[model samples]
Target: MSILINIEDLLSGSIVEGTRMEFKKGWNPVPIMRSICAFANDFENEGSGYIIVGVDEVDGKPIRPFEGFNPTNLERVEKELVGYCNLIQPSYFPRLSLEAVDGKHVLVIWCPAGANRPYKVPDDVTAKHKSYNYRIRFRSNSIIPNDEQTTELIQLTAKIPFDDRVNTFASVTDLSKSLMREHLQETNSKLYEESEEMPLEELAEKMNLSQGAKEHLFPKNVGLLMFSRKSQEYFKGAVIELVEFPNGLENPYTEKQFEGTIQKQLIDVLAYIKTNVIKTKVIKYTDREKSDRFFNYPYDAIEEAIANAVFHRNYELQDPIEIRILPEAIEIISYNGADPSLKQTDFDKGRVRARRYRNRRIGEFLKELRLTEGRGTGIPTIVKSLADNGSPVPIFDANEPERLHFIVEIPIHPKFIEQGNNQVSDQVSDQVSDQVISIIKYCSSPKSRQEILNFLGLKNHSMNFKRNVQPLIEGGYIDYTIKENLKDRNQKYVATDFGKSVLIKIE
Candidate 1:
């Protein structure tokens, strides 16, 4: 089966980087085995690399309009590959696909990161006297690792990244065809066109979303995260919790929880924020015709911050990704801090590049969806977005002694903060007139409108309630308990943090 990627994109080095691809004019087993061994090592934990034969390349780029491989030799090549692949110490075999690019047949070798890594092969597979050495990819070329690098490769033994590991609890049937097809379609992969005709198991294999012997295939963790709505069942706390504090964290705040496929959650949360939380403000000056336009918190900055949290958080941990939208700033918290290679200095300068990713496969899926730019640009992107909006530099708090969690605190725009403070003061001083303070204190806990009116010794009238309580709600002192269904018969009123603060100041 063909690998789950756009063959055209792979050749053009658009999606996959040059470091992860090697092009050859012809099939030579000796060097091919070396590249295979190096790719299996996956020294940088950057997911799998591919090798394409029957295509010539200069400076690691494929020369198009390639001379095609002989059609008659296809079977011969496959048969020989089996014997030659076994020469590696761990016996690794790459997935082979004959794809037609520019009407020429090129052999695409899909060398996924091996579960058993640090593989070694004979330097010369054809020589009478063989020398086996550990091989790894250095940029675009495959070469034997030196002593120091070899030691590092050995340390990676049996340390396959979590996302790539097989999920024994899940059967191939657990994989959703619709979600998988949707991803393939979104990525513009050739596999999507043939997905409908393929069996579930066959499709899973073609996509590299399943593992184990063919008789008892199981879905990989990455596959479930990308393709299953029930991913939360397997991965605990695999959801996003968003809390908004118009006043402060010390008072009552509205909350929402998002659960689904990670991609779905990401898209849904972003939409929710844009519709409800994000706000734009215009500042006009009498001396200037052009007004300054800026968002309270730039959407792009928030997008990168939350997307990075989702992509980097340890799924095994029970802590759900938490986004706290405070009046002064937004904080995105995720468990398991940045990689050790990232220093406080790096974070301070907004230049963080991880030595290796915690979830390489997860990064691959997110990048294809255009939700993230996976090559360690998440922090830099957030910094740039905030700077462009005239906001304060974002604060990264991953300096815990044990480095247990990662926190990104993005400050609100200065103008918005000032505006909010002024509005609150004005409401408390100027408009805290008729029964507003009494209503806020009465509704500290959730209370129906009629109950609040009865407490005030007033009759149940919509106009009275609007006059006494609507100002409190509009001033951010009160909130509807059922925010999504504001007009529900059972909806109740409650005092928000801002309202409690007002009562404390006046009373």
Candidate 2:
């Protein structure tokens, strides 16, 4: 039993004798009932507090321990307390306990704050007449409620807010016309011009925004998202934040904040990624043949991820969407508000039908943008792009009623050159070596220098490779045949049987 008070501690303080902490002698039901109510009410305001019994008072304060109450009488006290609470607030019952300290009996009643507020005494005329009403104040002081305070108490207990409160500050004028125009063009270019002069509200209605209406209350959907300028303002909890960590982990070295519309945020976030996250590197296959490359994550896959976040996130949740970039993987998190429709089994079996978006309107708009394709293709696209590039499949995990998190692990491929006796040496640098290997290992059977460079994720550094690859041919590791049809004198490097043998030995 928790010792809320000791005899010595009680003696040292000004404790009211008959409120929660003090008990008057005899079967004083009125004071005890009021104490229960006060204790229950206080629990709502100040978390938890205890009511103690069997303590004596001097000057309205407990100075010495009163003789313990009879153990046999505890059953009566328990029954009465339960009856009182049930008659008062049927939904909430305070937990009660009895204990003995220094041969004296004390009653400890614990009340929990009600989850549904404004609990009232049950509506039985006879019970209401018999039950007591009292308020608990600081220390043990008990006060008979005045009319004003009693009415205030009733008001405090009964107040509950409705769920669908509209934002009066947000109007149709805040929407972006240009963004809506773009979406219209993508969804049906023929109707784009026809709908140009339509009222924003009419457009919102025509797009089936009220399709899932319940009790005449329709939530703002995807069409509103594509057009709304102050969408975040209208939807108080909707915001997307992209954070970039220097080491790609919990502690971020730098962070950028983006708000307003999801489309604008997406564009800004992608630009930030291009500028800060991706890097280029050169991998040398031999002393003569060096390949220029970039990181292994496909640009298309990343775009799909961003589009997914914007379209699928639960805007009803007050949590912001997050993108975390780590050294080994990238994580995208959207507020899901309970388990997602898609499961690990669905992903494993390549069953796209199981996935459902929380925001259908936003998803359709993204599809119109060509940011995503027909039903359930985005995740597969992400998986295939990574796999085709020799990268690992992205992992997806759903957090119930809160978030859906996706982790894409960018695979690093290593270039191997075989000597003999199964001894392989990596002939690539760490920077872009993995990307270079992926290109060499997966490209069509044999490719031109330009073709290999492009396939190896080297589209950005075409000029650098053109100037630097000659040394590899001179080193005897790579051989190229001269063909008049090939405008460049050095047209292609068909890795010789010796080169393949070397690669095999290294592997």
Candidate 3:
């Protein structure tokens, strides 16, 4: 078992804090349920996260080591959590554990990435009374859900099996011997050498590629996909198209169509990306001495994104994988839609961290070739790399029903110098401000406090905003108006002329 992380380590930011402990004098199922959902959602959005329950906070800071909850009580709390999970739809339970720290029991709930892509709370009392929701935030204090988040959660709960599970009707002759030989070479030749004398049927069986009983297993489509030289011949949608555009999004400066086996196509595509994408870094200098500095787009992130597109793509969609490269960003779009098991908001929270390959055979083969690190680390790695590089977080948007798009924008670092008229910062900021302004403008009508929180990625900071929005209202930049349907007197905010003016100035 992973050691229970130290309280200080957790408090000092070693772990991503979701909801802090609210030590109410009495146990309340609603708050606990909300905390579990929030924390689990956070883990799903972020990866390998924690929900530290025990410590008390005052004014948003940990005030004292928890004087509440003893060991017996902690055990009772754990049992209650388990009961809560059992009641949830599809179940929102994590692998629950208890840690004793400074004589107080801290509940550490570890929510592993769902094998089913998305996990949802089943229709129980909690699900019925409370809305099915996920949370995210921009600043730090608000927690809110939007239509997009609700839709995403619902979509995630719907089951969509990996593409490889679909049986294809192709024969062993469809298998590419050359590709088989290459796979052998790439994976250290052990499997290839052992299977050399065996018949194709025997080989398929030995490799565990056959699905059902050996007698009924027809090595048609599976063989073609696994070993065929021209895999695209058997599966037309298996190819990847990599296009590098010039300065703008108009015509492509260079475009290459990669066909044949997935492995071969991936190798070729990555090589193409490395050659075409220009990477630059910033170097800092002292008053006298200069230091060597080098920075480039993270190879791991790019590779993972590409690998994910190829492996997780929905070949059944009959759309080709497309990689578009521009001066500012690289977009990888796969014809398949978002993982049915994960919500879009969960991506921002770093909540899930288990790899669920749409093509199990392809995933296994790629793992053997050392093309990808198994265990669902690809997305996290991509997010982390972008964060480290000082680039905006990559966006993963679902085009619905058909396509999953990933856009990675590589900004020119502020330190890099250009020839004439090098005002990249102003240009980029202006673009970002425009985007932010557009969102603000769209919410012009009086929205619920939740609506604004969702719009600004401030779901985690809802309470803070509840306290702060009044000041903005008092300042006359925004005003609160009551909702027509709701009985609550508390009003949501509408951007005032002043707010609009501020936006216009920035734009």
- For candidate 2, the clash count comes to 19
The digit string of per-residue lDDT tens for model 3 on 1-507 reads: 122233454554423333322233334556555544544443223333344456565654554656445556766876777887765545765654455567666655554333333334432334546555443322233244467665654564534333334254655445555456445544443455555666666555444344456555644344565566756765787888877776677864777798866766787676545433534443444443544333345556788888877767766666788887766567787764656666666666755443333555455556555566555566788888767766566777655434454433444333333444432223222221222355457557777776666666654233325323433454455765664743465766688887778667665
Winner on TM-score (1 vs 2): 1
**lDDT score, candidate 1, position 376:** 65
Better of 2 and 3 by TM-score: 3
| Tens-digit per-residue lDDT, 274-392, candidate 2 | 43454433344444454444354565677777777676666667777787766556677766422355565665664455222344335434443445555556678877776665556
- Highest TM-score scorer: 1
What is the TM-score of each predicted model, taking all chains together? Answer: 0.79, 0.44, 0.48
Best by lDDT: 1
For each candidate in the order shown, give its overall lDDT on alpha carbons: 0.82, 0.50, 0.54
Cand. 1 TM to true fold: 0.79
Q: What TM value does model 2 have?
A: 0.44
